[model samples]
Target chain A: MTETPTSSHFKENAHAALHDAPLQKALQHVRVNFIDKRAKAVARLPEFEALRDSARDIKDHTLANLDLYIEAYEARVVAAGGHVHYAMTAKDGVDIVLKLCHERGAKAVTKGKSMIAEEMGLNAALEAAGIDPIETDLGEYIIQLRGEAPSHIIAPAVHLNKEQVEADFRRVHRDLPSDRDLSQPVQLLTEARGILRDKFLSADIGVTGANFLIAETGTSIIVTNEGNGDLTQILPKVHIVLASLEKIVPTLEDASQLLRVLARSATGQDMSVYTTLSTGPRRPGDPDGPEEYHVILIDNGRSSMLGGDFEDMLRCIRCGACMNHCPIYHAVGGHAYGSVYPGPMGAVLTPSLIGVEEGGQLPNASTFCGRCEAVCPVRIPLPNMMRHWREREFERHLSPKAMRYGIGFWAFFAKRPTLYRLSTNVAMRALHWLGRAKGRFASLPFAGGWTRYRDLPAPQGATFQSQWRAKSGSVH
Target chain B: MSAREEILANIRRSLGVTGAEAPRRMAVDDRLAQARSGIIPQRGQGDQAARVATFKDEAERAQASVVEVETAADAPGEIARFLRDSNLPATLRMGDDPRLAAMPWSATALDTAHGASDGHDLNAVSAAFAAIAESGTLALVSGPDNPTTLNFLPDNHFVVVAASDIVGDYESVWRKLRGGYGKGAMPRTVNFITGPSRSADIEQTLLLGAHGPRRLHIVIVKGA
Candidate 1:
């Protein structure tokens, strides 16, 4: 269940991301593209906010009754002739998938874009077991060939430009002519389509992540615009659905309520090109689809998140809206966070999934701007959760010595009003007199982190308490 | 403890409840049985003619071609015409759908094959279980009647949806499915396809025909 977390070195990753020229160029697109499209989509639907509230309520209800719902869901799946496996950890999930693949003698496995798979590190496990795993989503395919993790949740290759993709394709797709008309985005999509279509046909097993798993009918739903997920499930002999425990909803109508906001928040589409609800393996008379269906329900610390301060984070639908509207994500891209999930959602969730000790630095990577909470389709209180993680980090002594000492120093003064006022007033007067000529400080003693980037404004001579005390009731 | 039992035990522990809690079980059962529609958007609600108009408009907006025929018998001709107009091959593959089999294919000089796709056909046609006005989606169920492959494997997909089957929202389709497949049961697959296959993965530039039908032609059977 435990993987090495690079989140402890977030500062270095963020610094490197800031200086990466091509990556900075690629990160600019997220700022330009998703904001207006989502705004326009929201503007078109007047019931969007109300629907978001409804979606939130549904998820809350499901989580509160998750154990019962899981029992109901498993019963329904078995009745439909599909198998259900409960995986207590990431390794358990990998082992279940490997055993299934080994039973089928599956040489090649095609995969839809599943962040759960990424979180479990499933591809590496499959390769270790000697089965080839092929990513079928165009974005996942690009990142797989380049041997990197997804930078963004919905768009895996968001940190790369077209030239970089063209180079990767040219390097890997050596069977094609070196100088075919590969300049346009459509040309690149066409090449991936042609290549992946063969893998889809021949792969013996398929794996996908569920957008929603309906307990009412034992159905697993996947929504995609590219239709790769449908092909991955339909064209194989075995279909294995990888889902976390919180994905279960009660009924089709409940799933519909969430779907109303999902595509609109993710890519600003009214509905994706394909929204498939698959119940089980092929029916008796069915001419197409897989012969076996299995759903792997993974806990991996999510059950512990229930009824905790971070419980709200489980309401996430992975819409990518929080990241799309995130200022920090736009500045540094997703790789800077150094987690499978990134941006504001990752900041709150990474600590819950992985411990606060290793993931303590992630929640501190935010500006607390509130845009993530505002744009979230499920209205997860992301900033508040990050604040909770910060409190836990402080309580657990995971914060650095300098930060703890700085806060201790401030707390000492905060306990005594008169002493705090005297010290601040004297220091403000001294700084004002010293920097009045320049009106800003290019460098300040013991404050190089701030002064290194930009100038700090000269302090006012009077403290806020003194000014307020003198001007009380007169200005108004 | 088994993984399943242990996981459930941990969830119950964290949630502060036993699995035998009556009210919780009742809540889950009630929600599933009721299957209530939460919030239906107002954009697609209207009378029949207005609903049909909105359906066609939304389908076209999603980049699918919409054509109306007088009856089910005339659907083949329109599909054949669509193939001719698009400069695609004059051949189509389909399943053993009774509605499609009953069509008068002799009315057009087009070649047709039967039973699910093996990824070689250029054109295929199927009968939609229902058509949604809101979001312009077509609901297709998997069976011997309309194999799932016919919907995705072909380059050009022609769907024959009866005019009377168009609904105002997705909830209505759910009601229809419940009536057909019984409560708490579903077909092997229920596909809600809004448009032809597409992807914006490449630098967020929208491109059609990414591993599914490039063209979706809907032949609405009016007054059938």
Candidate 2:
């Protein structure tokens, strides 16, 4: 069913992704783009690294007293004349939104890009309940039209080319004259803008995600470059902010601290174009704003992640920087991970939210290059958390049989240094002689997983220990 | 248990807390009460002239057009000149900001309307509550005085701020906000707008004007 939900088939998904021609072409844009831009932006701000530490400490302090802060945050929200709902599960989150829509008799709802909505599968739920939910983010709108999951957290349709988007626009907007020029990305954006403008004006309910929930003033802040989140929230009669629990910050200043690093690490902008801090609803005498405001604080297993090995993940601002810097993500793209999130952050977080059984393979897919941790705004030790997940997977016997037995066999020799050295030395000598002609192995028994896509360089008849000893334990 | 109670209870259970710890409550209360502004960069710290220079420089870097005038009276003529030079319509929409209402709009042959934008305006202008020099951000608080829609719904947006209102960092803006709205309170909406709207979602090719203003023009009045 649905091809076994690709996360469980991560290896196969990655294999298929490697062979995908168009996706490969589309992924080339990501490799040379975000890395250079983020480096440039981070270079301009000398205090960027220090700001990252401050951001990290802010999240750490808030999370340590998360219960009390949440209580205080809720109190401020109520005092500001807004309503806050807590959803312990994803279904409860969806049900809460559905109830709001039903109460409002909503015929149409406009939405900003929100990973939490993706987690709750809120769009499908609303559609099943006979309410139309329209995605307003240009990237999200494209993926939504194709009925596909997002490939990247920030750039949701990053795995698509201009040609593919043109085709999608042609198929969906059949009423548009076939002769009209849709040759460029800007034209597609313009067409979407014209169509969504009416949707924004007429929608009965609007749902958006909060970049941060400021506890001091009971504010839900949204940072966007397109200004779509503002249009989605302000035009409608009702505005709903769907945020996970750990998005809370103690004060406006903490939000500001995180904002400095968030945009820099995510999109390389000193500031996103629009950072709207909305508190409560429209006040009396205020013109052109939502009348009712609601915030659904969804836990969905995040509360359970607190005080665990994966607790550092709670500090994630969802800046998508970890994925941007991940090498494995560069290879396979986000859809291959097939979780709500992808890349290094997903590798550790998916198993925590869903389960180790369903999402265990994601953590194994990493090369552990540590790029994700290096670029994280809050400095999440992503590789360390993935190692913990690997331990959990191994303890549960969820890893492959060859891996279990192979590590076990290696451990037996590893425990005895003499035997380990003897076996490795003999094996190296045999392989060096066999591969002396080509100086490499194109294929080998029990190494298909490696050599299938890349070649392996041969050793030169010496174990690493011997080379280290000969070189006096120094390496260039 | 209610969803709120159960969720909070689970968070307490996971952290091995009873939700009644005095030290935890005190820490949260103190942090909220005395909001600490951390790591304001040196780039934005300066005197009035330096602050204006940085604000103009950073605003231009973010692709916003900035112009300085001698007085609040000179802003209207400059705006009219800018619209004419850009070959835009000589019409503008604005909010009930008294500073803008007092501008000598009749000095130029421009037609301006007052009130919120209903998503059908070509250009709109609003007075900033304050401006930040760090990233050239204009803080617009929502009220009858200035609707938030005017900041986002226009094709071209013009914001007028006094030079003295320019702050060094967002922390200074927060201080001004607390001074205006009191502690633990805020207006319905506060938008920190850096530039015109943009999106790189389409194949990561950056395009200006996805849904908000395609162009943002800031007029800094020196002697207001």
Candidate 3:
């Protein structure tokens, strides 16, 4: 199992991942699938562009008036006999959940895939309190068993191949026959089911994340391919929902707008296998739902983004479509960023949520390819967001002095035409003189990172400006 | 101050946006027209029938168990027969559908029938007013009569859908809902169910019945 990566450990892990050919191949396949399928899905819909625009507008409007909708949602939930709790931070969210567990005396927790829970680090907290928090989502459970964080947003275990998974299952489930053929997806699933069935039955509490929180009804909508979320929320005595404050949509109809695009963009499916809406807790006379329901609305740095240019980032549905299409992401993958969220959306979101001090390097990983923006269902300007973070990193003095000086020197000369031309002329002549038989630089000074990966093509004789001037026979 | 008042005050202070006046006596009937207008770009002819067809096709595509019947009276017997086949018990919680309430279900009762208000009925038989075919989703509304409990509390959930209530896509469904509920209108809750309650939470293995019903059954009532 891969160890949980820390800031100090990320560089080495990234180096290893970058060099791994099989990992690269797997990522390339995923990138093609996500981009190609999304393109096809969007092509069939004549009004897709219009729909995306409307979805973006709706989310923006909803977030701007989130206070009203949250109140409306609370009123609806209360009327439906559900309880609501507002949590101001990650710790606050965890505390609310822990309190609910304490009150219910919950011994075990079955959970659906909620990134918010991951953000709060709820599993560790729950385990510390002697309550076993079991991740019910197949991908989430696999990583949880290995004691690792999810590398990708959509497919948490995207980094792992079947062989690694087989090893994980063997290590975790010792009772299984040693000779069991675990290479096939079906066999792995069968073994997992046998073990998880007991956990589901025994769990005292169920926790889930909401895709959308309908303020009008105090209800949450959870979309999943597997049934884990339903079980996580329904079977246990106490049901706790962890959601970010920005998840609120004004009405079910609004939620519908987002749902139309979510599945098509994420998996190229008309819809996921299951989309369940939960309201409060089980009402009187109901047979099987939890007796108690608690909604822990978290505001972990989300409120700070409101009414700002970066506010559009909140519209993200965590679909992973952006990362799937991004060239930079395809090359580096999720682990390189050293954060929970990876890829284009990660590059934008992690810095905002975790602060620039921790995740400042993420934004710089991008080449501003704009593929992320093209694939984003909600149409977030990812490159612009990265630029904003870059600015923030510079202001915070988080950037290296060498990088700062280099950028500063470039900017200084670029503003002066004479100096810019002089520098370009000198650089072009030097590059031309160094150009070898193959017309590529195998090794070069000042461009170590670039040269390390592949040979840099020798500069074509003169600068573009110089060539253009000469072509026009107007060189001064 | 009460929780509502305190919450409102806190929100007012935080949002820095003045709270709009609550419209008194905003009747459902008046709002429905406004809601509908906002939802549909152009009032398409045969919207209802088209919507219903959309729902039916979506249900069929998703591999959901859908059966069409002529009348609501036929629902209990058909649903009961389905449960028997699936080996699920007949004991069911009921949603507030006037037709379902009026049905002579004692004649169709596979085991027992309980209203939405009945707290003990875990295996539920309910009715969805409409479904979206594009995504194979069933939409449910919660109200005084149609309590959300009946649909959720059960281990086996059975939904009786009217074929005429089916719609083509999520956009159309949104239009119907928006048209049904005008701006600022909030239902107690609306559920869009695609399939049975499921989770892949435990080792990425897909498991049914993690928190909600292990099974979901849909019976479509046609020409009712």
Candidate 4:
């Protein structure tokens, strides 16, 4: 399964997203539900902010000593009778997983919701290998049936309404009764539950993503509200954990610290319904569990993100808080970013993973409102990292010619204080005179992007600096 | 180079360090060895009765039903009553946990089966390893005694948690786990379940019973 990035076409994607009526209706769920729920959850926990700080420090310590931790973690996994596979690239990860399935003679594979699998494009690869990869998460199952990428990380089908899901279920589950009541969301859920239950029981392999990999005990933890991940891993003969290297934490206590903030930030729950920690496969004499446990640690591009300005990006726990609070994401939704990840975190991290040339447009999509960083469980400096990407885009000339010239013109005046004040003062006065009658510009040269959407309010007679100077002189 | 070696080398290169750096190695080792607790929330910390009360309150807040019995002997009766009240079948599936086995199931008029669920069970019961008051979560460790399948496959899950095993926060549960399983050694799976399975994937309207048990009933043994 190959993923062709349209991140370079972010403008067209976002413009199309803005006008798409169904998408606009679906995105309302995100804007209305997430913010209030997060606020209530935060209000319930008085020490939430303090926990966030602890979580951040833990990630920082882990990232700094990542090599040692990885070695320690690998040893522990081996000690527990599990194998660890390292993937230097996405293809290597997929290849390793496919090989494992072949060795086990796996024909059907059930999966938990995993963003890493999405990043690796595992479903397409599995299908190509003649392995049926069935997604068990309701949102993931909907998107999988529709043959589309996830619009949001945690809420994969956040961009679809129940009507669309009802349609998808009808289209896919042709064996089910046509007259079955499929009106409410609960009806759709019940139908999917019954259908996926069969996949869970019969699948030969189960795959899931790790929220945190504990190096102390070689444990892989998954946090989920739905029990789909639990059923996915437990019901199959082989349980394969697809995780990036940065998911590692040093100990269970460190994992606990991160867990305190993760669910609250992501879904506004005190704790997700299930926070399962799996060490190896089924232990000796265990009644039920996977027979073989394999952890495929993929580094794709995260290792290069260490010890740099973007190193803080590794601190992310994939909580989706950044996107939940992002204005740009609320406006354009996840697919508009045209990367595996979206919103503020995606803007900074996608470039490093995919390449700056293709993913550079993502950084420019943000409004720099700083809400993402404010609510981040690990306190990653998302806006600052995005600014860093913008700088790199300018340095490498990846930015458009128009944007380069515009910044250069601004820099020319910005470097000279007198010229900056003079030019701004003149331009403001001229615009004030020109817009005296209407007090806004419906159309303006070189500002079509702004005017096309909404009228640009005309500038007042003088810039803020001149007004401040006049007020200060009068006061003296 | 192998993928493992190449990936580690790239990480070391990016961080501008050799893998053998002493201080870095020491930091990692020390953290793993110490396993120090950080920022325990005060909400879950209190006297024994307060902790139990907090656990019950928090669990209910997470949408799980909590019932307290005077002793372990009364657990089966309570489970039977819950089944009858909910209009569920009088059948229960469970693993061979001693605490659950010790309960006098013969006293109740319910049919019981042993071993893990095969995804067809309507009701299942298991003994919790520990309960965290901080988030009203139950910690269940997987083994021959309490099979992991009992936690997920049943339509209704009933957990019997001893009141004495209820801890203040998650960190306390880790301390208990280390005491039981030894440091740096864990069960095959340690499940921290807060409530019945749920999902808000559809239009952000929260719904319970999305794959796991539709109802989670906790019977807290107070005196035993």
* Candidate 3 lDDT by residue in tens digits, A1-476: 02232433445656777898767765765666667777887776666677688689778777666666676677777776778888766887788889888987888999988888888889989888899889877778888988888877877876666677888999989887899898776567667656776676678988999998876546688888766676566667788888888888766566767877888888675677667777766655444567787888888777767767688899999888988887767776777777778888888888777777777787887888788898788999999999999998898888889999989999999999999999999998789778946789988988998999899999876899988888889645
Quality of candidate 1's docking, in CAPRI categories?
A: high
TM-score for each candidate, following the candidate numbering: 0.98, 0.97, 0.82, 0.98
Residue A292 CA error for candidate 4 (Å)?
0.6
Best by lDDT: 4
Task: Give lDDT tens digits, candidate 4, residues B1-224.
Answer: 89999999999999899988788878778889999989888999998799999999999999999999999999999999999998888999989999998999999998999998898899999999999998999999999788999999999999999999999998888888889988888899999999999999988878899999999999999997
Model 2: reference contacts kept, as a fraction: 0.89
User: What is the descending TM-score order?
Assistant: 1, 4, 2, 3
CAPRI class of candidate 2: high
Question: What TM-score would chain B of candidate 2 score versus the native chain B?
Answer: 0.98
Best by DockQ: 4
The two-chain DockQ for each candidate, comma-separated, is 0.85, 0.87, 0.21, 0.88
Query: Cα lDDT for residue B140, model 2?
Result: 91
Kindly list the per-residue Cα lDDT of model 2 for residues A190-269, writing each as its tens digit. Answer: 99998999899999999999999998889999999999999999999999999999999999999999999999998999
Q: Give every collision pair in model 1.
A: none
The regions of model 1 sitting more than 4 angstroms off are A1-3
After superposition, candidate 2 runs with Cα above 4 Å error: A1-4, A436-442, A451-458, A467-476
Interface RMSDs of the predictions, in order, are 0.8, 0.8, 6.3, 0.8
